[model samples]
Target: MRYLPLTETDRSAMLDAIGAPDVDALFSDVPPGLYLDGPIEGLPHHATEMAVEKHMRRLSKRNLAAADAPFFLGAGAYKHHVPATVDHIIQRGEFLTAYTPYQPEIAQGTLQMLFEFQTQVARLYGCAVANASMYDGSTACWEAVAMASRVTRRKRVVLSGALHPHYAEVVRTMAKFTEDEIAGASPSLTATPDDDGLIARIDENTASVVVQYPDILGRIPDLRKIAEAAHAKGAKLIVVNTEPVALGALEAPGNLGADIVVGEGQGIGVGLQFGGPYLGLFAITDPKLVRQMPGRLCGETVDADGKRGFVLTLSTREQHIRREKATSNICTNSGLCALAFSVHMTLLGEAGLRALAAENHRLACIASDRLAKLPGVEVLNTHFFNEFTLMLPTDTRQLVRDLADKGILGGVSLGKLFPQEDALSGGLLVTVTETTTEEDIETLASALEEALS
Candidate 1:
């Protein structure tokens, strides 16, 4: 049974009504050469459900799961232990079936959870307030840059060379339509800063300076100095944290004078479900800038009888209200994922989170120390959290492939993302979470030795 809702006559009539002589007229705006010459090769006009399911399953089988092999991969998305209870609680009918709360009065529980989630994020980042959540770490970082520019009323955005490549691309894409000036610091996988200096580029016209915490190379920057430099030029400092677990032991980005702190909350409660549906934590300093922040914010309020209740506040800047003038067009909230984060953090508490963070750092340090002893392999980061970059004597891409064949999930290859660039073409960035065990570290170390040898 074909499921075509419209008949040939109906299509013709609709096209005629729209004053288009043919269906091809609808796509007149698309250039001739750009038009597809034929249909896609693999896709069929029709297929059985079982065939489609089998095809999808076969394609999925090609992918290597994190648990399938000794895994060690993290630039932004991480492999962390998500307790079964977190999944159980989020899957409840009431919470799982809920959507964005348009009516604050009827959505007390949802609003309260969001409010508590905001509080947790603010405390973790040392900021005044946080939104519910954004799309992901990259999108959140992009929004932070845009918000900083709007707040400072400036045109220039300075991107650190050490910033994640994907994150830098997102910012560049957003800046294109606004015609804002974006200067990128030189690209390098090495932890140490070389000739291309971004700190020297800041001036009065600079709206914001963006740097990543435990950046692409897994080296922690002296953000206090960078923040001071940006402030001296009247620019807001937007700090990005792809891995938020590092915050448990490291100085909060807000305390280092960061105007905005943005990061992926996957390490907290979200699962690395093949890099999807992760929570983005966005926080800012003063209450004045709260209006410019993206996403919904939940606040405590009083009912008509003076009883306390929670409600969605300052939603006028969302897509539902301002339309084109909205601070963010985002509508769907990572509500369940955010709830999972809150629940996990509540269970961990401050001390437990700190201990978990320390354990991650310890594992990573041991792994780096062991791997650095191998010939032709060098540890490039002096200061880091749970992740770091390694310089390989051979091409990192080939080394990674070899390691994968050996049943070891190797770190991300720099050359894989930046193929044209020379600096990062030979390096690989590795991460060790609290979930990573000593045996995992040994396997990675031994696998790298065999792959290189």
Candidate 2:
């Protein structure tokens, strides 16, 4: 049965109330050439539900599934092993049905989860405080820049060459509307860290110097110099961590003097479901800047009976406060994803996380070492956590496709991300997680060798 709530009379009344001649008149402003006169060009008019489902399944089969092959693709989104227990916990009725904790009295369970999430993130980043969570790492990075601008009263944001191009683009798009000056350098594809140029760009007018930890190319450069340089000029050092698992092995950004630490938290308890609902981890080192932090913050408190409880501590979004006075326009936190992360972190604990991080690094090192021995291939990073870039003999874009044809989901092609940069035209970003097996690494190495040969 067709489900049209509005009848001709209702439509006519609405049109008449708006002083429009007819239904077609409503779209008079749209150009005739651009308007669709009928059903979309390629779609069928109708089909049985089962037939439609089968057709969708056939279409889905054409695309590659990361898990079906020896997967190494990681340029922001990663493939990590999420425990089955994490899913079991998040699917509980109380967790799955819960929404934002607007009222603390009735929403104590969710509030407590968020409070625990915040604590986990703060400890993971080694910061004083962390918000509940943001949209994702990219938007969270942009928010950090905006917060820096607010704190320093400056408009210039300096981006490191090693920062992910996609993430840098997000900051650029957000800065475009606010008239913030963005100084971004071309991607660094060399063996040694090339951050001197980025540091030189920071001056008195700069609001923030944003650098990726174990950057897009997967090199872990010493950030102390960059942090000091930004601090000397009254600018904040904002660190981006696309892969949160690296935190398990590397020194926390806050301990390294970063003012704001933001990154993707999809590595823990979150599967890479086609780049969707990933977690965003945001933290601040100083207490004075807490008010400027965006999104909702869950806090711990005591009730009148002296019983410990949880509540929504700060909600500076436009929905809760005046538009002009709000710290950010983001309405809510990534509650479910944050819960997954909290649960995963709780299960892993400190020792387990460190071991997992160590395994990732070990596998990455083995893969890099074996791949570098191949003809005309060079590992670009002297130090990396679990992911790194490789300079290939031929164009990386074609090589990636060739690898895919050979049933191996090889690493991301840098040329696809930054086509304009000739230096990165032959670059490939490969990642190795705890999930990567010895056989998988060997398969990639052999396939890569055959492809280049």
Candidate 3:
């Protein structure tokens, strides 16, 4: 029952083949004092199943779940009410067991779903094409930069100040081994985003200008202007969208001339399962860049019988292509999450999506109006879909902790996002969706007043 695949003789043979005396010899470099000899300090050797279950239940009770609090947190991952229908569909036997479509003949259902998902994403993003899906938004942002570097053959990337700090860091981290040069700055604590300043940073050497729509600070930047400037300098415009719901109300970045659009698709259908297995959306408005895009692209086609079907028309992942020629090294796509998003989008048709967006903005405006009346609080953005930055009179990081102590999942603090930037210290990023109620907003407002006073 204890499924140990290898016998001691088998292990010894392998270790001997590798010229090791024993397993302990394998870890010769590890400090003897640091090595554990036996049972860890004081843990019980064993426990009854019921006892363990009870212990776990007690531990879980300490966690302040999003539903149990006045949740306002959203930088990348969001808290939205995913319909029961989304779950029921994704849990089907066919979808639950679906994996990479190595053979299209047997995976018609999976392929067709992916094809439909891609179509929905393409239309949602206003792009000519969208990949099946990627890891998550931050990594997708990095992929966009790498793709831009490939298309333009330039090494310099200019990042907007308002771009998500996590996304920017991911780009910088990935750029270490590559020749790409990243030019980035911390966001300014103002209602207006520095579009002009960002444009000035773009030059002939720039391969891409990356900007986030409904940015980390919750202020929307003018993507069209940024796109035009990037084009003038022969640089691709990479737009990152963290909140896909905002797109229902705001113009798609692709419509504003973004060359490559990458973002987190966690806002729809996907519940924030404590950070991940979220979906990443990557698309291209310019069809010319399709060959250079990452991940798989499912396209409609026919088999030997000539009946309409679907297949992976293009997969540039390293698995399906020569390592040197592959567009991306991603092992697999986020298939299940993509299915959930597609199903949710299908349920919320065009009208439902718009109505959802309207309610979000309506509630957000109400929260903003109520909070702005506080003695030292100021809502920074003059316009926003559902999320915005609030400049607090006190240190925001401490205030957030204080709010959390009161069982309220307060907004993200700029200090936590960009710790080194003193100018951004007091900023708080608050998000509001239909799930956030008028009472929740009041609870937060009352809590903020009491704390500030």
Candidate 4:
């Protein structure tokens, strides 16, 4: 049964109050092509339960699950083996049902867990402190830009060409309302990242310079050099890391002189759950700049009985304060995803993480070597962690579709990421993780050879 309860008079009153003539007029901002004008052609809304279930089951089979193919897709989200224990621990009733601790004092267990998560993120990022979490990496990147503006009292943000395009877009989209000036450019096809060019763009008015470590094309950028150049002009250096596992192999952004580090925690505890419900990790190397940071910061305190306690330290986002004073408009953090990350990090520890990183690099080297030997494929990275770029001879968009048709999940194509840029149409990003077997690489190599030929 349909559940819309609004009477015609009630809806008309609401529309008139908003100065909109009808319900359709309320959605006038939406493009006409996007929304449906009438009921769907064939499917009945009130079909029998059995019929609906049967139809849904048939539709579900069309999806190619990651484990079922020679999967290599990773521009931001990755496919790694999550330990069974991570799922077991997070699914427990105590943790599973928990969301944000609004009445935080009584939610000791949740607070303690968040405090631990913060500690793990801080150490991982080599930052002085970290917030509980944010919506995801893109939003966290925007928050860093906002924080840098507050610290430097400047409106200009210098974005590196190698920064993730999606992250860069998120910053630009949010900047439209905030009046922040975004200076962005497309990534070059050079083997190494253009650190000097990025530094040259920084000026006195620049609030922050954002760079992604092991950047979009999977080439490692010189963070220390960029950090120094930005700091010389009294601008903050915001580092974005999409693959947290790379930090286990590469240097932490904070340790390399970044003022703030933001990244996706999905590489850790969270698996690629069809694009969403991923975690965001935010941290700052300079403790003095903590107040300007977004989201919630959980801290330890002594209770009335002198016992250890956990509490929300700074939640200056829109919910707790006047809108004008809020450091961010973000209202909630990814609490469950944060817990999953903490548990995975704890299980890995420092040594285990390093070992895991080494294996990923080993496998990636093997895959890259195999792929580079192909007749028309050119490796674009002089140095990388586990992921790298390849300049292919063919239009990778069509090639990717062909590979998928052959029951193989190929890497992300540049055409998909930069649909408008004709020059970048053939670049393909290949990501290798510990879960990717040698056979999978062989399968991809053979497929590429046959397809390219």
Q: Which candidate leads the pack in TM-score?
A: 3
Query: What digit string (tens of lDDT, one per residue) describes model 4 on residues 201-309?
Result: 9999999999999899999988999988999999999999999999899999999999999999999999998878999899999898787788888888898899999
Model 2 over residues 340-451: C-alpha lDDT tens digits? 9989999999998999999999999999998899988899888898998999878899988888888899999999989888878889999999888889999998888888
Mind giving the per-residue lDDT tens digits that candidate 3 earns over 244-285?
A: 898899998889999999999999999988889999999999
TM value for model 4: 0.88
List the candidate 1 regions with Cα displacement exceeding 4 Å: 1-60, 193-196
Please list all clashing residue pairs in model 3, or write none if there are none.
none
Comparing 1 with 2 on lDDT, the higher-scoring candidate is 2
All models: lDDT? 0.86, 0.89, 0.90, 0.91
Query: Candidate 3: which stretches are off by over 4 Å?
Result: 1-56
Residue 389 of model 1: what lDDT? 86
Q: For model 2, name the residue pairs that clash.
A: none
Backbone clash tally (model 2) = 0
Error of 1 at 163 (Å): 0.6
TM of each candidate vs. truth = 0.87, 0.88, 0.89, 0.88
TM-score of 3: 0.89
lDDT of candidate 4 at residue 312, scale 0 to 100: 84
Look at candidate 4 and tell me the lDDT of residue 400. Answer: 94
Off by more than 4 A, model 2:
1-59, 316-319
Model 2 residue 87 distance off true place after TM-score fit, in angstroms: 0.9
